[model samples]
Target: MAMTNRDRGGKALELLREGLSPYVERELRRFLGPNVEAEAARLIGEDRYNAGKQLSDLDVAALLKVMWESWNDVFRKTLGFAERSLVSELREWRNQWAHRLRCGQNLSLSDSDPQGLLVKPEVARRQREEEQQTVPAPTGVTSSAATGVTSYAGGESSSPTPAGAPSTTAAPLKRFHGSVALSPLRLGAEAGRIAEEVLAHLSSLPGAQVSVTLEIHVAVPDGVPDQVVRVVMENCRTLKFAVHSFERD
Candidate 1:
């Protein structure tokens, strides 16, 4: 006898889980390491969920939310192309399931093409290049003595001297400051993490002192707030440093 719709769906889900098993296992290993798999197997059980419970009316919305969050976490933590490829595949599967749920149809979790999920090394490299390009370069403090105008790279007015005053050579290029404002969602730990990452990038420049100040705003996650984040680096002899800041929402 042919299998019922529920039975077929259950089998499809089983196949889907089986197909995803290797990728999930790989991610778990990377996140928790090789020993973690043994612990996970022991704790979560080798079986996926009870077959009878798998076909019930699941909250697809909540499932999608959790899957997206998991994908982001994995993307942030995993470093190489292989790991990223696994994440992409998982995300695609999640999207397919979400579309099926939206159409008010049941989905069979069957395995699809795994290679299509893996990101090509060249593609990953280009993505990194694009990301690097998007970040604005740090603007250095340009003095009127150097450019004959009281304007910095960002077009902000620097300290102006008298029109007839004798201009001396730029004051030995002492330090550089890059100011930024944070969004409401970028408070506490998120702000701290960004500060640390920015500092790390700044510190890579030769003879640069990295110092960051957070400007708190009264407003939260709406329009741009009144506060600003000022990052100051002292004794920067070379002009190689880049400043990048982001507001999280």
Candidate 2:
């Protein structure tokens, strides 16, 4: 949003005024008492203080504080919601995103490669093939049941089995494993709650044949505190999740 705190503060003030103005006229004026006109000028600012002047966007916060001090529940709740970023965390995430991007840009340059040359796809492919020949996967990354047919491992049996012979089929349960890059800005501190709500809703949809299993891997920057990681992990513990610290470069 490229917003300063005052910009957010001002926008919040506008919303507060829109939601509270009518109520103020209907009931709050009585509380302001006899000095209503002076208060109107006071609410706006000395610059716009002429008689019959209407309230300005800036007036919203001051009036809200006045109502809050008067122990008005609605104003208190509204202010609290904005301050907490509970309604939508994105509203306050702009500057953090910009700062992170700037840091990333600075880190991507070097002496020999000032432009930060990237590896070609063919070179990357060769590297991958070399790595594959050197190391085999100890465990498979994906297992499938939804898309596969069940089968016997030893051999298919056409003839009838002898009495008391146990029939068996080896079918591994399905699982998919992968890491997800968590956007600290977009997900923020509310990542756990948002993740739960999304997975729950999607799993319940009509066409979902099986409950989805997820393992979310958070790419956390070094400066983040362990407490934050713990909180997010605890909140989103329904799925397999781990906060992995990653360096910028």
lDDT of each: 0.44, 0.42
Can you tell me which runs of candidate 1 are displaced by over 4 Å?
1-119, 128-137, 141-174, 204-207, 215-249
Q: What is the TM-score of candidate 1?
A: 0.27
Clashing pairs in 1: 180-229
lDDT of 1 by residue, 1-249 (tens): 666543454355555555655555566566666564344434333223321222122222222222233443443464554554444444445444423333555443223422222223343345445765887534564445665656555456645567999875544445666666665653533453444446545676889877765443344466443344332222221433454344565
Candidate 1 lDDT score at position 138: 41
lDDT of 1 at 216: 35
Clash number for each model? 1, 0
User: Number of clashes in model 2?
Assistant: 0
In candidate 2, residue 223 scores what lDDT? 64
Model 2 residue 49 CA deviation (Å) reads: 8.4
lDDT tens string, model 2, 1-249? 476543454455456557766665544455556676566555434332232544333234344433432323223333464433332233222222212224334221123421211222243345445765887332343224664432332343233345899976544434423345556564432344443334444455666554434344445555657787577667766544444333445
lDDT of 1: 0.44
